[model samples]
Structures are given as C-alpha cells and as structure tokens.
Target: MATFTPTKPRTIGHVDHGKTTLTAATTKVLAAEGNAKAIAFDEIDKAPEEKERGITISRSHVELPIVSGSGLYALQGTNEELGEKAILKLMDADPVRQLYRPFVMPIEDIFYIQGRGTVATGHVEQGTIKVGEEVEILGLTQGEPLKTTVTGVEMFKKLVDRGEAGCKVGLLLPGLKHGDVQRGMVIAKHGTLKTYKKFEAQIVYVLSKFYLRTADITEKVQLPDDVKMVMPGDNVTATFELTLPYPLDHGQIFSLREGDRTVAAGVVSKVLS
Candidate 1:
C-alpha cells in the first residue's frame, strides 16, 4: 500500500525545441530503468492531413505519465498536443498555502477525451493519490459506492502519476461517460468520505437586500431556489437540501448561488447523514 504525492513537471521551452520529444524521451528512460510504468500523453494537433497528417502538439504542454510509487517524471514524450496549461483549466489559488491534510477532491467539471475517457478536474482539498489506485465517488449514488480506478493524473499539461493535497489536477477515469458524473461530487478513497442530501447549516442571507415582491415573480421569471425571499440578518440557521447527494462534513463552508450570483453563504452546522 503505497501513497503517491505526485508532482507536475512542465517543460518550459520554445516551439519546435523538441518539448514533446523531451517528454517522450523521459518516458522511455524511466521505462528502461523499470522505475515507473510510463504513459505517453498525446493531445491532437491539427495540420492539413495532406501536410503532416497527425502532428501532435508542438507548442502547448501535455501530460505523460509513468505509474508507480512516486510516479514517474517521464513525460517530456511522444506525439501529443494540449493547451499550454495542458490538462484542464489551471486555477492557481492558495499559492502560499501548503495545507494538505484531508483527502477530498470535489468535482468542479468533467471533460471527455476522444481516446482517454472521462477526466474529472478539481483542486486537491486534502490527501494524495496515484494512478492505478481505486477511488470512490462520494455523494453520487445512494449507499452504492461509485468506485473507479485512477487510470491517469495530469496537472498543468504534464503527466502526473500521482497527486498531492493542494494541486489542481485532472483525474482520468477510463470507460466513464461524461453524463455518469457531474459537478459538485467528491472523489476520495473508498470508505473515507460520506455523502448527504439534507443538512443543517448557519447561513448569512445576502439576497434579502433584493427582496423581490410577489409581483416580480409573477411578472417576470423565477429566481434560483437558493434565492428565496429572506430578510437581511446576521446569521440564520437553515436546513439545506441538495438536488443531488453531495459529500459534506461539519464546519464546511459553501456558497449558495442563484444562477451565477451569490445569494448566501453557509457553514455546516450538523450533517444529517
């Protein structure tokens, strides 16, 4: 039972300076050394088929992996293309915070690759993981554990065989359809997390300032459920229910938004299962 604290290594170089070649070569060297199981990550590049046919990414970053204990740094390989940031949209927050204690990754979005399968992108809230290990999707199914293995991990366009607590990562789950998962789910080791539909919380009502009259609703459109009528107040205890089951713990703070606007902020007071 090995724990992987993966790292993302992006090659900083210019166009045609052999970044892909450098990535691919790293995979080969690691495979030869039996250090890690190397995986060459390739993103599609478009050139007129009459010209280069299938030229991989030339300027952007891509992830290539070598799965094992510490995972391999062997991505510098093969033909592939990806965004300059590589895997998912990179959001660099908490730059000064090195806090890695828990092992919960809440799904922000999921993307599908033509050949690789479903990729769930999120920031590591706590803990670490490596490819080839099994993880459970908390709060997605009722009692039935949504278990899947990590086929791949990537960050900032570099193949990361494992991941740490604070990195923005893309977890690759092969054979999963995009619809099988959604935003706001948590990924964790099996049996390590819990999901709930109803909870008690203390919420600061913000939308109260815009107390819409009954005429507003009848005359126009409906607001988001979270934007219910409320009076401005210090803090109020509220019962919260998610349309879908979601992993939540006591003391968790969350934003309640109506469409795109924040209506309220909540802190978990008690988790009702």
Candidate 2:
C-alpha cells in the first residue's frame, strides 16, 4: 500500500489577491495529475461572508498529499507578491526543534473497557511511546505525577505496538479507573513532564480582555504591566498565573480565549513556579 504524508501549503498574501481561488485551482491541478483529490471551489470558500465579499476572512486549512517518505512536511505557496524565492527560503530553513521533543499527550477523554481496563485517548503532541513502557500522568492530581504502564496502543481502532508524534491513539492503561483520570490530565514519558501554576509566556495578538482557558477551567488573567497596552499583531512577554496547575513544558503553545472566541496565542517561555 502506498503511504501519503500530509503537507500544509500556506496561502499568504494581501486582501483580494485570489489566495482562495489559487488554492482551489491548485487542488484541481493536483487532482488532474493524480497527486491529490480535487476539492470543490465552493468547499474551499464556504463561509457566507466569504461568498459575499469574495475573500476569505478567517484562516483556513486544506490538506494536500505529497508523495514523499514517511514523516510530516510543510509546503509554502504564496501569491506573486510574496514570490517563489521566499518559498524556497522557507523550505531551506531549519526544522522546528520542538518536533524532536519528549512525548506529551494531554488526555482528551477516558474510557473503561470491561476486560481491558482504562483507555486514555488523545493526540500525541510529540515524541514516541510503545507498549510496555512507563508513562507519567500529570495535572489531574496535584503533588506527584502518577505512573502507569502502557498495556496496548490502538489507533483508529487498530492495535498498534507504538504511538508517536501526530498520532491520535488510545493507550490501554491498567489499574486505573475512569474517575482517576480526566480530560485535563496529561501523559508523558516518566519524569519528563511537570505541573505548573505560574509561567512566563510570549503572547501574540492578544485582546485587552481575555481568559486563560485550560481543559478544566477558564480563569481571567491580566497581562503583565509592560504589555498591558499590547495591540493586535504585537508580540509581548507576559507572566500568567493559573488557578490550577497544568502539565506545561517550555515551547508548549496555548490559546487565550474570551468566552468562545480565541483572541490570542502564546507559547510557554519559562515555568515560574
């Protein structure tokens, strides 16, 4: 069977530059060449306002398959204004260092099978894990992290011997009950994860009023004194304090939301406490 690696082709350009149209055209061309399946133009720009204004108002993603060796890859495609040389430069840039980091999976849900024990389902954020290896469950409980053994790994219902970064898999953890684990908890390679209630982060495009939300709670937080006047598109370093500790690590990215809308994004720069 032939395997395909998913690649994201970024469409970045000024307004009304036909970024969406170009993407739709490229999809059709790739389909004609048997490189990808054709996606309908309407599907690419389906928002009502987008149809009325004939421009995309929100960021969107389209998966394009590239026939390459097994691994994740990124492809940059921009309008003429950005130029092909810019894309070439990006392709030659160094790969992100976080891709090589340790295993970390924030538990999204938990299930208890009658005979197999507890199953924790989540997407692996980074690193690799295999059956029979030990993992630490962090966050849900305070103080020390909980250790558990991975009895099995299953992806899309098919039993796999191991799981790695980018894979959404279920880990069969024995000796754990449903109540013992929750959505906000995190699982990582033993001794590699830490829980923190305070941390310094570099945030971008944050609104004046927003809440720091995690899996279990959403708490209002203030921007540091230096960045209180930050505006959209500005990058600022700020310290954030959460009501509860979470399994956070350096370079881990998070979102700041006001109610249901995400107004900003941030990356953990340092753990303060």
- List, residue by residue over 1-273, the lDDT tens digit for candidate 1: 233343354544555545455455455555666754545534323455513644444343433342221112224322223322232112232244334555668787889999878899987877877889888876555556578999988876667667776677899988777677767567887788776767777777744211110001111122346756666565667665555556677888766546657676767788875
For residues 31-83, what per-residue lDDT tens digits would candidate 2 score against the true structure? Answer: 55577776665687778998898778876332233322211111233352243
Instruction: Give candidate 1 regions above 4 Å deviation.
Output: 1-102, 140-143, 206-230
TM-score of model 2 relative to the true fold? 0.60
Query: Any idea what lDDT model 2 has?
Result: 0.68
Q: Give candidate 2's error at residue 43 in angstroms.
A: 29
- What's the true lDDT of residue 58 in model 1? 36
Highest-scoring model, lDDT: 2
Give the range where candidate 2 is weakest over 10 consecutive residues by summed lDDT. 66-75
